[model samples]
Target: MSTTLSKSYYHATSSVSLSAVTTRDLLDSVAKKTPEKEAYIFPVEKVRLTFEELQRQVCTLGTGLLSIGLKRGDTLGIISSCAPEYIMVQLAAAYIGVVLARFHVGLPNSLLKSALLKSECVALVVGANNDDVYNQLELILPDLKTSHAETLQTDEKSKLQRIITNVEASQGRWKSIYDIMNLCKKDSENGKQRLEETSKMVEFGDPYTIFYTSGSTGPLKGTLHSHMAIQNIYMMCADRYEWTNDDILLSACSSLSHATSEMSHIAPLILGMTSVILSPGAKIHDNVSVIQNEHCTVLFSTYPGLYNLLHHGKINEYDCSSLRYVMTSASTIPTDVIQKVSSIFQAKVLHTYGSSEALFVSGRDITADEKEIIDKVGRPFGHTEVKIVNEYGKIVPINTQGELLIRSNFLFRYYIHDEDKTKQVMSVDGWYTSGDLAKIDRNGYIKIAGRSQDVIMKGGKTMYYASLVESLLSHPNVKAAYIVPVPDEELQEDFCACVSLIGDTSISSDDLKDFYKANIGIPAYIPKYVMVFDDFPEMLTGKMDQKMLTLEVFTRLGLNKEWLVHGRKA
Candidate 1:
């Protein structure tokens, strides 16, 4: 045998194949075939766009961005809800390989400033859908109110040079998004050349999006994902879920700032599935009518919203039988809830397990027998490698609780601009350390046994226990505070600020509200409900008995029935 390996040996080394495609490539290919097919439907705005229309919008915006000097690899931040304009900016930026840093329209000053600085965005795009964007941005960029339409020159330290807006405000403050779109069209000479050059420079390996999530024991982490990463996940998910071009997908909950946005927005856009986007300010009840009217094939989020809708029999008023399946990964659903939801919709309940690190890990399809899906997160995808490892980094045996390690090409490239955080979570060999506690059985099904991180999934947003607790403890009137998850009918979970005040400081609920109004405006932290505790319960091991304390809190809040029906703190 020769020292060098043969062609067969080289091929056998790896079973996975890389996808050589970008979001732009997929959209272009789909639009070419389905030129007149409906690609997006914005019910609230009464807007419907075909494949060609949407493609033209994306290209126009991409060219306008190029005209404004935001080229390939430049960071472009967006602050808006999941409106039609927001989608346009997202796709347009991706079209020319501009990295997008999606900011939640509801984000407070504290979080937004940090994210903006860390992302180092060259330009920020503001959407007209939400009014909060103005108030929030004005706090960070003091010059936002005074800067002319040309470029932003602020006292804040970052790469920010321009502020673009789709909304009408004071004239010289920002550049109109509409004006920018028409800027290149206004100059046809340079526009064509820049568009061709920019499109050609776009590569499959370019970083497409930065999805920020709450850190386990630290600050917010922005997960950088490549075009290849996003494309692979969409391709794999569509194949696995048996999605077809005829499927009409709607993101019933959350927005593009979420990790699931890739599947909801980009997947449907590129894969020929009709994307039904709701305008900003749509209430929880809007989904019911949308599903009834559009005959949406799939509902893309949630736990409590659907549960409450069905539990109260409100869904009976609508003909939503067109739904083929409801996909959710916001949090684990109890077995009883899964069965109830499936029956209510007459569709399969697909419970997924995913995170910012590893886009899609595993999922459970509700079966007739409870044993099949009970406490199980199903098997890993074909491209994924999973193992339950102990504290010592050794692989544990089947059915043993340990940290779940995920290895896949679909995993995020890294934590954006943070090498230390990236190295902390990922191993040199490419294993991602997921803090979740899980177990693998002989049948190859994985069961989640809780997790190490004190994370609360409120509605569809991720809130860290440490961040809120620290904010609470920092108050002059507070001594100790513990943030606990409370169940609700609307929001999947709510936060209860259980606090033990410092001596002689008599701060009532109103005082807490006032404090939150001044210091913490994030709804996830300063919730509507607050509870004052004498002290938190402790275990024999001298540590806080979080489980017992949570139960006590629930009982006191008169929410005992919430946990009994769910069976456990999932």
Candidate 2:
């Protein structure tokens, strides 16, 4: 690895070169260069496809899409897990310049309705499972008994024209993906000719797909990433992380719909690395077995994923010596989880920090005593620039806390169809305000304090939940802690600290407060109310469900009435 350690703003430079290329170009190069090389290893499905086969499969699907009136730049949304069908649609959409959009597998009816109208996806593809990915979606589609193609009608007027799915429904309106694949066999010459012509229309700047935010706080917003932007991320990561053909990456804690999995699915094939993907909702034991059986060398996971794996997973009984780096991101990783993963897996714990706006902005591989400073997200990646700006829109000194801003070639182009939201975060000169409070120390290590929204803005004083949560995490009996804002008639907002204990250990709210008073040391870092939770709910991305947890706290405390500034009843 390159020695990126430095002072002065933590901007790491790279000697590697970059280019503007579409995803199709990279796949073509790899397929021609190493046709027989393994591109994917889906151990759960007992499926392995070579580079040449992957190329053919994507191309076939690309032409098939065009045969059904789908044109370049038409949005095709996918609702699936880490299945082969999802990969085919993802790459095929990129091959023909059709914009891809994704929805969570567990999307609710209300959110699905809201997203369908605004997402502008002309077609939607679902997984083989009729109940999981397509349950809520099927409610809006024509009934299963509908016989004619004219019966295809959505509840509202939408761009939706076709509903392609892996499952073959009895109705003709629902187009089967297998039928789309068979289009190549019927008109092989015409399909291939049109595929070539359509491929030429693709450009580096065209929108590749839209990724929805976790929506833990509110409704999901569609973020658009360009073909060139994703390619930049792939090239930069291959160079920065020093990934080789020998590296085997194992996907954990996320589905293909997540941003973290977007490039992981395509870039590994282009970079000549073997990617092993397990099914979504796979148990911890099965995940550990895949690493042992596949001889996996690397893993990308979130905090809860690591914790669940180490705590509940039978690591000592299995052979996990092949692990090289346990890369983590998506949320603040607890130091305990990092130490356990590093110690058990004998791997370097690499901390990463990014958002929907930009992915892979900064990461640090923990070694030696660096585990003690696990809060730092290392330095900025190459070809990326980061700055801290105050509320007045002025740049701040190093080690000062302010909103984080970043400029990179790999950032998402803009929020799709929401120009006001785009202008709110992205500046005219290209610096995207992250809305995250952070700092760069003298040694050039970046530390995330908290999100700007995490602060309690009331009583003319801003109190950050990060400090109090950090204190709560420092408690030996605490496992996870979250400070959620509660409505107040006078202060406008008061907070309640909800904590989950380690294992079966228990502590009263009074005892927890006493421990914080004696050991916390920082008087400003205190909580107004405290409640205990058996465990916090987690989103699909393996991050804590802050929105749902906040609601639970409110419901438990009876938030309808005026609550005091201190000592809230639980």
- Give candidates' CA RMSD values in order: 12.3, 3.4
Best by TM-score: 2
Work out the TM-score per prediction: 0.77, 0.92
The segments of candidate 2 whose C-alpha lies over 4 angstroms from its true place after superposition are: 1-12, 141-147, 168-173, 365-373, 457-461, 487-494, 561-570
The superposed Cα distance between candidate 1 and the true structure at residue 288, in angstroms, equals: 2.2
Report how far residue 78 has shifted in candidate 2, in Å: 0.5
Model 1 score (lDDT): 0.74
Candidate 2 structure quality by residue, lDDT tens digits, 1-570: 333333224455677766778878888988998889888888778999889999998998998999988899899988877477888898899999999998877777777767777778788887776445555666665443353562245556677867787554433456677788787889999999999999888998999988888876455778899988777776766665677888888877566677877656866655878888777757888767888898888887767778778778888888889988888775476777788788889988878788777977887734424743577887677788887778898777777888888988888888877899889888899988887888876655688888887787545467777766778898888888898877656766667889988778978998988887788775556666789888787775556788778778878878753342353432
Candidate 1 per-residue C-alpha lDDT over 1-570 given as tens digits, one digit per residue, 9 for 90 to 100: 011321101111123355788777888898999999988888888889898998988888888999999989999998876478778898899889999998766665788888999898999887775556776677778787765557778665788988887565534456667888888878887897888788888899889999887433346788899988888877767765778899998876555676776677776655788988765456667787899999998887656456545544368789998998888774345556667777888988777788877888876533324566655766665477787878798888777767888888889989888999899889999989888877776656677755656667777776666566666765666756777777777776777888877556788977886787678767567765677877677532122567777788778878765563573344
| Model 2: pairs clashing at backbone N, Cα or C within 3 Å | none
- Hey, what RMSD does candidate 2 come out at? 3.4
* Candidate with best lDDT: 2
